[model samples]
Target: MRKRNTLRQGFACPERSTMTVHDAVHARRTIRKFTREAVPEALVKAWIDGARLSPCSANQQPLKYKLLMGDAAAPLLPFLRWAVMIAPQLEPKPEELPPAFVVIAVDTAIRAAGAEIDVGIAAQTIALLAEEQGVASALLSLRSREVPVRDALHLPEQMMPALAIALGHSAMEAEAVPYEDTHKYRLDEDGKLLVPKRSLSEVLL
Candidate 1:
């Protein structure tokens, strides 16, 4: 069935492989640079379908998603402006400022119900699937009072808004700066791409 919230008409996957899924998990990073070319709506739907299968608490399916595309910037863009300005300047580009916007509330259907885990799982599922298909996204969190995107989208009142992931086909490639293993992380060796952590010998008792 076609997803209710997206205009994506059809998925365009030529090579089907779970390795792609794994690669997406390891390779996916927050992408801020996007090409003006709009990703096919159907492809986006296919990713959403993949997300729908994420496991929820008791499979209660507490997630509700809404996608924002094009100039539909009124909902969450202005709030993101503060971050955008401070954000590392994007690499120079020539195309239309790619389809850019927010992933309005990604919330669980119940309040204070610990559904965040389920919601996060679904969001990551969508993101990883996007990466496998050559699309990229940035997961962002912000505080704003300028507008009510929730009501604008007519999302349920019970759904709690989570992270707002800005998505599109990135014009630039992103890298996963390596992070130190939690057990190996330490302050003395901290640097870009080199996360701090404890050695396995030190971690294992």
Candidate 2:
């Protein structure tokens, strides 16, 4: 019998050094401020590949993605509201705007009812994948500005813009803080984002 490569064989095992899904979930955070560095097309495609695999209701998948870069993404900034908790202070400055965006849309003609949940699943999947790729992201619901955004993207009658994900290298730090009295997330004096997270004990009940 021929000897096999132990390292290659063990790579698929969960005990390996590679980051696990759980690890990526914990490490993923909503980053508002991003560096000017652009996210490459290859990585964006890979992220979308992962998002496309997200579980959907009754397998009636109906999500669409529009990739925008640099100037293409700049127009979206005025429509997206970010870091509302800290408002202007934590908002992305002109120099710190994300270099790319992924506009998630729903094909209403397919299955319009449950598309919102699908959007969440796809957005979270992309965010997790982006985290693994050393990229940061912010998820925006573009609800109030949907009309204008839809016009700007020139979306077809059947396609409705649902979510917008800002992508780039992180320019600030965000950490999950223990949930105290308030559930609102805030920025510290050092401008670090403090996310409020409830303990497992409180949530398992």
lDDT of every model, 2 decimals = 0.56, 0.80
Instruction: Please give the lDDT score at residue 159 for candidate 1.
Output: 51
Worst 10 residues of 1 by lDDT: 185-194
Q: Top TM-score: which candidate number?
A: 2
* TM-score (C-alpha) between model 2 and the true structure: 0.88
Clashing pairs in 2: none
* Candidate 2 lDDT over residue span 1-205, tens digit each: 1111122332311112355678778988899888877677666776788899999988888998998988888667777878666788778778998888999988888976667889999999988777766778999878443567877887787788889999898999999989999988988889788999999999996
Assess candidate 2 and give its lDDT.
0.80
Which digits, one per residue and each the tens of the lDDT, describe model 1 over residues 38-121? 766566666667778878787667666666666664555544432343243442243524474435354434435666677677
**Clash count per candidate:** 13, 0
For lDDT, the strongest prediction is 2
- Lowest summed-lDDT stretch of 10 residues in model 2? 1-10
